[model samples]
Target: MVAEAQNLKVSVWRGTGETGEFETFDVPSRESQTVLDVVSWIQQQADPTLTYRFACRVGMCGSCAMMVNGIPRWTCRTHVKKVSENNTLRIEPLRNMPVIKDLVADMDPFFDKWVSAEALHHPTSTRNDAITPVDATTPERQAADAGIECINCGICYAACDTVAGNPDYLGPAALQRAWTLLNDAKDGGRIAILDAVSGSGGCHNCHSMGSCTRYCPNELDPMSAIAGLKRETFRHALRRKRDA
Candidate 1:
């Protein structure tokens, strides 16, 4: 038994998919320790076979996102002091994703939705064509700028309740990316992109619960982007009806 003052009681999910069980560990408490540091310590000092993922420890790379105390966060940036309750921490793989192993959630489905949303930019000009000068101050550019900082971390995807309940939902990150591309003046796939997200499983499925925005490490507002897509798709539908 660990003395309550010197050690942290950490309960970590240990298995694949829904078959996991929480394995508790008592780790020595330290000042200014990040959650990623704690996991690294566990893997290094306590258990060597523990599976997890991390790249840049400084939080630039979004590869270290995990569920800390029931909330999705970039583990590298999450200080243990800020989240631990009574010197206890609960660490697990991100929610709404298939667990490949302990702390490593498969991101294929999350990215698949990105592809389904047609979030990639389709350039209007060929390489040989002159570069199109875009005014950064334009409303479209500003809208695009607001959402272009996403690092594909999957934190927003994990926090989305729509993704949890609706398998077909395109999700906040993907929809937000689509919105950025939609506003890009040089993107040529606007029609297809709009069509992709206009489906029943797309932006319209969002409940605007703001979970994505609330948990995003990059401070992006995916909810606002989804709202924009909703408005744009509605206008497109109205135009289609008039043209019919």
Candidate 2:
């Protein structure tokens, strides 16, 4: 595999609860090898005590995200050659979250942010009522569909400095979901959702660092999503002011 002679020196974190060290391992590099493959090799060949979290080796699960070379990414899809620095790699837990152990960062807060964002849909029509049809090609739905493929990997949140600075900020993923729901013409909670994201710790809090968009694996622009939220919130505020 991969010429079987060269060695890759990798430094990985080990342990949990604020007690851990960067353990080094040497493994043979291979063609088209991903970062997850290298880490699995270390656990099987080098140290059995290594701790991490991974459900699927593919990118769909979004469970294998971590800090690769100080950038948040899905390790399962990340290639060794793409992230390795001078034949070495430093892997750690994702930022802005609790480290469970080694590379497994706790995702509880990340999910909670989703709940706080109120990104869920609330149907106004009863089940007995006539079904309403929506055109998928509409401008609003099309804009919503552009960034709707997010896998909730938390990479955007980890890469966001606004989330790191203000714990109350809903972060990009949740806001992206909110955008999707808000654009749905049939959703009854549009005004409520606007109210939710327009207040303190809302869209105005974003500093536009663009790290979330820069590091997204799916090529989404959460920065743009946040800007859109700002505009919508301002429009809603002006409407309220005029009504008052």
| C-alpha TM-scores of all predictions | 0.96, 0.94
* TM-score for candidate 1: 0.96
Find the 10 residues in a row with the least total lDDT in model 1: 1-10
lDDT of 2 at 208: 90
Error of 1 at 14 (Å): 0.5
Q: How high is the lDDT of residue 244 in model 1?
A: 100
Estimate candidate 1's alpha-carbon lDDT, on a 0 to 1 scale.
Answer: 0.93
Best prediction by lDDT? 1
Candidate 1 per-residue C-alpha lDDT over 105-192 given as tens digits, one digit per residue, 9 for 90 to 100:
9999999989999998798998999988888999999999999999888999999988999988989999999999999988889999
Query: In order, what lDDT does every prediction score?
Result: 0.93, 0.86
**lDDT score, residue 133, model 1?**
86
Candidate 2 on 1-244: residue-level lDDT in tens? 5455678999998878788888888888888888999888888888877877788888888888999889998999999999999889999999999888888899998888776777887697998988877789998888788778889999999999998889888899888888888887777788878877876867789999999899998898888888888899898889899999
Name the top TM-score candidate: 1
